[model samples]
Target chain A: MHQAIAILDSGVGGLTVAKEVMRQLPQEEIVYFGDTGRAPYGPRAPDEVLKFTEQIVEYLLQFQPKMIVIACNTATAIALKHVRSQVNIPVVGVIQPGSRAAIKATKTGMIGVIGTENTVTSGAYPRALQELNPDTSVVSLACPALVPLVEKRLYRSDMARTVVSQSLQPLLNSPIDCLILGCTHYPFLAQMIAETVGPRVSIISSADETAREISTLLHHRGQLETSGKVPVHRFFCSGDPETFQAIALEWLGEQIKVSPVFWQMTRLSR
Target chain B: MHQAIAILDSGVGGLTVAKEVMRQLPQEEIVYFGDTGRAPYGPRAPDEVLKFTEQIVEYLLQFQPKMIVIACNTATAIALKHVRSQVNIPVVGVIQPGSRAAIKATKTGMIGVIGTENTVTSGAYPRALQELNPDTSVVSLACPALVPLVEKRLYRSDMARTVVSQSLQPLLNSPIDCLILGCTHYPFLAQMIAETVGPRVSIISSADETAREISTLLHHRGQLETSGKVPVHRFFCSGDPETFQAIALEWLGEQIKVSPVFWQMTRLSR
Candidate 1:
């Protein structure tokens, strides 16, 4: 029973980060929470998102997690600092890791970001990127249309490609060599995004980069699991457990137990 | 004045890291030390490498650097922990960063490592890889020939291509999807190395990855330089200043001022 990394996301969008964490650090146990009942926190107001994130963190504290990852882009942009102030443990957000990665990957000094309405409006990507390298030119697009499609499990549909193409048209004209998938949900549509963006621009999955940084932070803290034991992952979602279970299975590419889970998360109300 | 990242290597190998730091964090200043007189610490005794690395750190401490990067793999394998005990600031080593990157990139779980004699013999890569993931399969090959070519600036010669092919012959057959350029110098021959190993393997440059982690560490510590002023980098070499300057200019692809230097490093005598 290793002290797990507690990861909280608005919905299955963060399944991308969880999948990478599972692949990259196989021995570490994961306790993931997806607030699918309030799925697509992107278009929501900042204070509401922050309150919801705080509720999830409070719920996860019962596990005595060694670290907390705000895996949802919208949630990370809104509540990362607030969450860090609340917890004594290491709190990692999806923003800075993606920003650092884009800074590493970009050759043109111009970078592109596509996220939710809340994330883009918060101006987190530009602030994060420029904070690391002030000279970086950031072009941000709010893909408010994409996350709902993912939450609804329509990311594989032809409509996803259509929405993705139409939404990305403004950015294709820019001279960015590296595009940071500012939203975690975007990696689910990565293939369609890549084909639309062409071969020159590199597509950076913030979720994957965040997973790599989690390994870095854990390594520096000397908390990396050295055990040979296979980890049994636990997942909790606030919405339809069946829909969550279906999404988790398809995205994580494995059997993830998400049953016997009551959606009583509203009890931790503000 | 922004505190600089102090980088030390056994000749120009760590220039790969320094170059990346400059490129990725353009605003951050760098203080680089190249112990060219004691070049190729690869085949040296671990005690000797450790002693030499300590001497460089002692000399670098005069500048009050915020971070000390043991950019040389051989020296890092010998001295990272010991140096961390001596310095209050963060001490970064190249090995773990590369190991983490390889883990992230490797789909087959079979990873390859190519480094100098000391780094290979230290079993650092395997330990680092397995520490993060107990299931990772690591195959390490010590390419003692690559570093010397880089030291002599012969990395571009036809000899380099032939030597790279001959040296990497044992690894080509391994079912590895990612090859960690374990030695900082190996990136100099990365082109030939990549060609010889074919496109099946993703080349993981520890030097570049180490620079990326340096940013992550600084960001977490809230020490990333925010001033818009351009950074003036300093270079010092214990051996011939002229040869060191020549290699610096070529490797860094920028004008590096290395002059008015007396080779009195023996003053930090044991």
Candidate 2:
């Protein structure tokens, strides 16, 4: 009778958060939705991202989850507050968690953020970090190429290293001690980014940090699952099921079954 | 007029949390109480520890703080749930934060905890970790000598190194990736401990973790300080003011002041 934690993302990127939740909280159940069909939400308009996010959350709500997690930085930057206002359960976003972890890890107030175009344009990481501490200084860059690499399930390909290196060229000279992986998709390329940035800059992944936030919030509310039984997690994707399953299996390192879902497509292309 | 976050502890050990909160959320005002007169709650009975914690919380409540943090491991182990039941505001403890951090940092499910005698005897760290994920394996050691070194503000002395090494001798063979500084006081000697354990074991300071928890809870509730003004923090200790001031100034790396408070000295001689 345990209520699952509902997680929604733009695509397979959130499998990072989902994997962490499963590892850190083995007893808890999860219901996940990945909107892969319309992903690279990175380049989409805010209104459209927000609308898509609302639709995904509405679909997941039927699971009667105890908590809702917006596991995509693009969606979170645009829709976290809106989703929070709409839900009775607690709504968690990827931005603030990464911001908090970076604040903790950074000795210098200079923090770096690399996210999707939407998250960068929204100035969400800067806003989140500065909101907690006004003295914090942030530098942001949008790494638009990284998300599609993950969506296509090719993060391990040598081409990912090239795209990551190119996208992160501008941040190489920044004096930040800690870099926030502001896009959930960026974690798929973490090794390449880490090698590029070297050990001096600690990397803060929003995908991992969001899992901690969920654990903390659920524990405080006395909503943590303690059934001591293996939980059956369900995952859905509004796109090609085989592609989503392939990416999920690779990212999560488990043979998980994914259900295909359909959604209405709108045509205001950028 | 900003409402303060009230923090209570057995002694200056709580300053670890205070320092983190100051560094992480500079805009939030803090009101701190340290029961230095009853300094070593770690060796005291659970009932006595709980009573002392209640008295400190009672004194701190006069500020009408927005939140309460039980920053001492001993007091938190014995009094956290009781205090939560009595207060309306969110009550945070150091144990869970350290536990969560250790869980996240561990590649092996094996975790290590070093705390006060009471914290170890109470089995709070094991409970906190296993409660979240039953697969977690924890090894606990009660470093009773460590608190006195920090309390006396002698953590930098040559004798402190010998004492820390002797105390950590038992854990030398454990296969843990991350070690939890279960006692708040332990962070004062973090450098020496790190040197002793070598680089393989990652050290976690519960003091720093608790600050993250406070930030997360406040943000979720939309109660984060947005005044954008430099906050004035207040600290009180029930022991000799000079000793506490020396420790506070040294640990916090600032020329700040501490107020001396007196409590009814209970005759329950341990």
Q: How much is B215 displaced in model 2, in angstroms? A: 0.4
**A28-106: candidate 1 lDDT, tens digit per residue:** 8999998888878998889999989998899889999999999999999999999988889999999999999999998
In candidate 1 chain B, what residue range of length 10 has the lowest lDDT sum? B260-269
Query: Which ranges of candidate 1 are over 4 A from the true structure?
Result: A259-263, A268-270, B259-263, B268-270
Residue pairs in candidate 1 whose N, alpha carbon or C atoms collide under 3 angstroms: none
The total of clashing pairs for model 2 equals: 0
Note the DockQ of each predicted structure: 0.78, 0.86
> In candidate 2, what are the lDDT values of residues A128-223, reduced to their tens digit?
999998889999998888998889887999999899999999999999999999988888899999999889999999999999999999999999
On the 0 to 100 scale, the lDDT of residue A156 in model 1 is 96
What would the DockQ be for model 1?
0.78
lDDT of candidate 1 over B11-128, digit per residue (tens): 8899999999988888899998988888899999899899889888998899899999999999999999999999899999999999999999888899999999889999999999
Question: How much lDDT does candidate 2 score?
Answer: 0.90
